[model samples]
Target: MAEKSGKAFDFKLFRRLISYTNPYRFTFYFVALSAILLSAFAVLRPLLLQKTIDESFIPKDEKLIVFYISLILGVLLLEVIFQFLFIYFANWLGQEVIRDVRVKLFDHMLGFKKQYYDQSAVGRLVTRAVSDIETIASIFSQGLFMIISDLLKMVVILCFMLYYSWQLTLIVLAVLPFIVFATRVFQKKMKTAFEEVRTQVSNLNSFVQERITGMKIVQLFTREEIEYASFKEINEKHKKGWIKTVWYNSIFFPIAEMSSSITIGLIVWYGGLRAAQGDVITLGVVIAFIELSQMLFRPLRQIADKFNTLQMGMVAANRVFAVLDTHSKINDSGKIELQNIQGNIDFEDVLFSYIEGEEVLKGISFSVNAGETVAIVGATGAGKSTIINLLNRFYEINGGIISIDKKRIDTIDLKSLRSHIAVVLQDVFLFADTIFNNITLNDPTITEDQVVKAAREIGIHDFICSLPGGYHYNVKERGVMLSSGQRQLISFLRAYVSNPGILVLDEATSSVDSHSEQLIQDATDKITEGRTSIVIAHRLATIKNADKIIVMDSGKIVEQGNHNELLEVENGYYKNLYDVQFAEVRDV
Candidate 1:
């Protein structure tokens, strides 16, 4: 449902879509040749039939009849060969083009800024990248090429028809105006209908994906019936959208068929009349005219449907190109690549917002010296996570000077800047793969032994060894097979293995039990021992011994000091926050 651009049949867009064939131009030209050959081969059988009937049948010449029949059969055999090559290569080319297109689409998506994803639906994107691209394949296989071949065949048939009898050719030409007009009308109706179907498809995909991903919440709240009702409403719209296309097809096809039948009836009636009037029109000529008429009208009829395929492909291309045309990716124009990064982080007068005019981090200033651990303690929505996001260049800042090792972070190559930092987030997401693959992320450089060593350093090696497949244990989607605490351990192990110069823990131990927290605390101590670390924690007790603790409220830094120094301040923000959390622990 992105804003559509251009017409249903955009020549520029069509030209661009065809440009993907540039990589396989040799194959593309070959496919074009096949189409031309197929069309040329098509008209031969009808011409041979005309010759057979005219020369052999009336004379009762068995030898000539057999010769003509054999020639016709030979033409058919060649037609079949070209037909097979055409179908096979056309489809192969379509698949190759889509393969290249899908890869580029996905690569474009990967570079998009996180804000783009925040505003976009995953399912709609999946539909565009996956299903929508599939539709574009038919544009090459069954749409453009087939239409061209059919038209070529029709043109060749018309030439032979005119050669044999101009009067019958004129009769056939008379029916074309009606067919063309009806086709234009059908084409316009189907274009609109197909656009609606594409929109509904995106909506349906988004709804179903979201509901399935959140199915646990639905069942926990006992909203299955409510969700099902909503799904039915979306699904009903999808059905109605398709039914509109079907309705238009029902109306248009029968009209086309009746017209074709009428054209044949006219050919028979008029040819017989010409013969009776002694105009020298033979029986064979009349039959030839009938065959040519069928050839002409059949493509005319099918062209409308083929046109719909082309239209639908164009619609999908429009949606896809919209994404490729987006300019929301984070600018990575920096040339400086970090070498021997010391991890000296600074945020001077940083200002940011997820939404304009509503600042989340207002002129925030902080610093973390090399190999020092700084803890940020704040209430929910205090812009703690937003700071981390900006430092990583995941979101562009409105106004800020963020630097690492005395160099502007934005001037540091984005990849090199991130390669030195590892973050263990509160919500850890794992793929549907083995634990080892998730940890190493299939990096060939990081072997199983290195993963095990990192896990041991984090004190999770023994726990992993207890699983069915140890390091190879399948964690399923989002690590659903592991408990929340276990997943947090896996995340800690993942971070530890990276050997990052700067480590970030965003409420990493917040959801674990006392036993798991003890293990995580040990891992945190081991990991942050010699690295510059930023810890965002809600629990004051967790960071009681940090070198510096910064307290935030709303969007500004309210207090900063060591635990003892801050507690000494009578009404300090950190002192008050510490008291509240301490009292809660005491109450428990």
Candidate 2:
């Protein structure tokens, strides 16, 4: 677990966050100007009340009283207008900044290598990109600018109170030390509470997201009660985290309210005695002092709350910047532009490990001609899938030379290199969209007609047409509406439509029904006719007709030959695997 940051006010973070507002500085400037006007107007209202009570209301001057009332109302109207502009512009700027930041964060995430994602939870990333960014927005909407405006209003109010009666102002200032102390304590406690709350929120989101995504596994294994119990514990922590924040708020606000009330009582008592003694203090001065005291302390109370927003926003910004600062992206230093690659692939003296010092592929060497179909047969954990991951440069090899058409694969442009290859994985994924959209992936250039043609070529067009809405049928999330075989067919069509020079089917037919397997086999023949193809299979019967078969064990290729040639070798790994699979089929 990462240690929590101890610093409260991170000025460096504040400055960096402010830089995002550069694009909308004009709007921010408008908000600032409105704040100044609003502060001026707010001060004028209390002064107008003082004057009305002393001069207009106390005297028998109806006309003067009416004039003063109208003036006060006019000041209020302007205050309302400026307040509207301040809120509108502040929120608008905040929303705009968050939009840009979200996009930038997503783009940065896209550049991260598979290694980064391998250890990251999808739910945590979503939290950073969505909830964290929203919290940062509150720094503008309810935070820094609002605090500045409120502080300014309070400052203006203080100046007027002193000018009216310095004695009353002194009395109000006497209780200031206690308010300041209480605020410091409140802020410290709230910051800790808010931080914990955010952590719990992220944890809860991660737990729920994982559980919902893997609900099928839970149901299949009959682990619903166990999973539910685990979720309840997480949910309880989430509730406790928020309740802590609420507990702090309940203690702080009442203390502030009590202090404000005590100040009002003190003003009323002191001014009454002075007035009765026939001193300088009058009813108007006493009334204004009470109002001014409220004005002064109200903002102080608000500042504490706004500071919470600022603190949470800073924490969010810290997380977001951490992601932005990561340098774990794949090195796209290779500038080679090889268009229309011949699909000749070579892996020589390759070494790789998903974990350091634990090699999954050890000094492996292999080659595939431009237009040959090769089958890789292996048991679980034999580094079959790792081969595909390394080939596509999803991960950097520990030590190796992987080349295409005699050119180093690393020297080729990543986009261009990936454009010429497509892999249909065993666990096929489909979007919650129509069959047509899933096949084309919403690529504008790949027309519906073209997708239909590709599907027909793969022998799944008729099956697709039999479904309701045909090509336009919605597959639901992860293609949950379709059978496993139908999903595989969709994957095949998606791969075929790309017209990749090299086709990789990584256990693509392992989980499908026999009928679906036949369709996939037929699709395989049509699509891999002239393409360089590598098929990773556990079911040995699927690759009997391949041009060559490579048998692997413990990250090493133990045997390589055509089916008949390999089967003839007594005690060979391929022969044993083939015999075991054939016997199992016969038993079935």
Candidate 3:
């Protein structure tokens, strides 16, 4: 990861980000007001010191001293009250900002074309939304709090120092240029370290996540030792990243503290001798200057700390913007609107390629009327799945047209077009929620009764009912809590629940055993009764009842016929596949 240019820290991103909390304006205003009020105490409490020394003590008046002391206590009490308010609001804003960013990020991720997911890793996307956003929020909340308050306090102290003595003010302020120069250097080094930390940490997260996800496979292949050693190396790199961050911070804080202390000691010594030389400055004034000197650099120290935090936050903000800035290569023009879909689909001379000059679907042409079922069968990478993807507009066709009911898909608003399609894949992914939720994920507004009904129609209701919590039973990662057959059944239920005009079942029943497969076949036959359906599978039996069987080879349809007709073609690929299946069955 590259450290952002100095110009990248401009307020544009921050201004845009603050708009996320536009709905919560009152919260923001009150927090800002409270911070300002709390910061005013820096000037007020120190003025009390000046008054006690220059007036109350000079007159030897105990009552006046008591009065000034009481006023200082009151300012302290008010400061504490506003400080509480400031803390509360900043904390609330940080959480809300993080929540808003995550919500928007997830929504955009879903809208992204399939190609994005194919290129991006789940762990990296998660880190962007969770870890990166959280780090930025911390800077906004706690770090920003320290920065604003410290700067305000320093300004007030500087003004008082100038008013009391310009000569002293000039002497004391000379050290500021050195501090600022040092801070700029620290920020530059820390930024580089911060970038290293980000890249290493994310790399570590990706590696660990992948290892965990494939841990069972590793054990099956006896690769545990290799995986463990690789993990240790990545972990060490992450540790080194942190070490660099700590090294910069360690040098920064002590240098800041020692410099401030040395400046204060110099002030006391020089001011002491000046007073002895019978200058117009009083003993009381000298004491007040001493007190003010200590308070002066307190805020400066805070500013120094915030500089490091700001660098880290800036690094995170750049990463987040890079994600939010991504736009899909294909998106609808918002002109096409379909109130209803008849599911008449056509692919007119369609050509597609995920990579340049390597067409996956070469001039594919097909049409299916409403309520017709089409089967696409081919060897692996023969472009059977690619054809379905183009039909659903998951990928923009490199050449030619795809339309539904005579309306071109690209012209139709994507949301309207996609709403009419339901897809069930072999690789099932159920949320870590109840079975009812997983089935009705497409239509969350559906009632529990409707969910159960859909499940029954799909032939999975009875089995689900037998589970410990019925439809409410939890489905863990990839629905590992349920059997493979059960997961497939739930996927079938999900597709059916949408009542889509067109259904795509891609190797949907591959996981089920023979008995459950028979059940699912019966259920799908009923489900696709009046819908345009496309089935892609290696198993010939699954698509036996399809209205049209499309046999593809080398990215082109080589044959098209019904089961009996295809079997009659002695030289056809479908005939060869059927012959192989029968020969294997007879041998077994």
Candidate 4:
């Protein structure tokens, strides 16, 4: 979209990107100095060539010839040194700036609300943080500064050419319009091509990542061929986007090279004619003009290429900045920090909707006293999980107040609020790490002893010790090395060790095997002993002993009572749910 805009150069975006170099001012200034010196050095070589021909070789003085040769070699050596410094420091600056930007981008992403992630693709975010920032780095290393240096070199060469012979310079200028016109057209086309390339790259990344992550489903459902077909289509689009840029390049560079050759040819013919007619155009000037033509036109060719690099970087910056500009993060404006939170939670007529006018939880009201264990039961899509999400402030409620210990959750410091609660979801996620690290989450305050003590209390210590490395046994990604029951145990251990005042188990044992159900139930009873716990479950048997059971359907609570009390009520929501589940268990 930015590429479609008439303005090829976005000055505001360019300035914002340049601001990242503020911390590396010394390296930036050094690279700038190298550019100016390299430009000056480029002009000196051509002038020295003119002097060498006229003042040394023409006079037939061997001393002057050797002296001028030594000076030329010295200039060349200095030029090489400065050229290396320019490239090295320019790249160093680019790398350093991108490092800072990537860190900032990741940090910004971490603070975003759950709603943000719900609407975004993981691979697209990965591309922005990784590849897109890498493109921005090129803006410094090969794009902006390289364009500046090349332009400066061309200007210096032009100055030297005009001073030598204005007539010869005019002849060189005759072919300039064609190259400039071609370069402008090439840059514009390349800008759009680069934008398409980036978009396709993002799509390819997202497609591949989703497919790979869900590979088991693909194979299980025999959808591999279908998925591969989808991938081929996406991959083809990516290839086409890149090929368009190459097509433009294949057309533009030859035009630049031809224009340079034509200019050089005209200069030689005109200068030679003037010399034969006894005009002021000397042989030395003619020789110098030939070298200067190359010096001038080579940069012109390179600037066009480097300008595309600049354009691509600008496009990347625009996308990266768009993410940084997003206001989707949970507002952590609450200054209140609760110490030793009692975990008394209340949801007062709360309303929420993932989409506007389609409320998921409508007029939901609930209360849990300190140190109480309440079970929330419902059919699927009954806004059961939405309650847990709301409690954590993962999404702002559409209406009403959620509070802990009588203080509004919105008025409590987010970190402090979450610190007092630990949630163990049904679909457990574990890092590819040892059980010890997963339990402690690498928290320095939560030592191995603390984890072991908690595990023993929860009756899972024996199970952990039975493993090859005990607490040190690696679970691999998502605990794939372990079974569904084992991962649930690990999740329980993780929640317990945190010593949270409030614990939420969102269908923690829903997927566990029958053999592991007793261990899970025992572990659950042990952990919920004194803590204020909220258990969401589909099985009626698991929550029968709960002090309170809240039954929900659709988007509202239909019943609230203990198991026996709800069963006593005829045609009750909880009574019907219990009868159906109990019948299913009996049938099993």
Estimate, for each residue in 259-313, the C-alpha lDDT of model 4 and write its tens digit: 8888888888998888778787877888899989888888988998899899998
Overall local distance difference test of candidate 4: 0.90
Candidate order by lDDT, highest to lowest?
4, 1, 2, 3
Residue-by-residue lDDT tens digits, candidate 3, 335-418: 878876888999889889998899888898888888899999989999988887887788888899888999989988888888
Task: Report lDDT per candidate.
Answer: 0.90, 0.90, 0.81, 0.90
Identify the leading candidate in terms of TM-score: 1
Cα lDDT tens digits for candidate 2, 416-457? 888788999999999999999998899899998899888888
RMSD of 1: 1.3
Better of 1 and 4 by TM-score: 1
| lDDT value, candidate 3, whole model | 0.81
Clash pairs detected, candidate 3:
none
List the candidate 3 regions with Cα displacement exceeding 4 Å.
1-3, 6-8, 18-30, 334-340, 442-445
Candidate 1 lDDT, tens digit per residue, 1-588?
A: 245653546788889999999988988888889888887877888878878987999888999999999998898999899888888888999999999999999999999899999999999999999999999999998999989888898889888988889998888899888988999899988989999999999999999999999999999999999999999999999999999999999998999888888889999999989976877688788888888898898888878889999999999988898888888888898899888888899999999989999999999898999999999988999988988899899999999799999999889889998888999999999999999999988879899999988888778889999999999999999999998999999889888888898999999988889888998999999999989999999988889878899899899998888999999998888888888988998999
Native-to-model Cα distance after best TM-score fit, residue 29 in candidate 1, in Å? 1.3
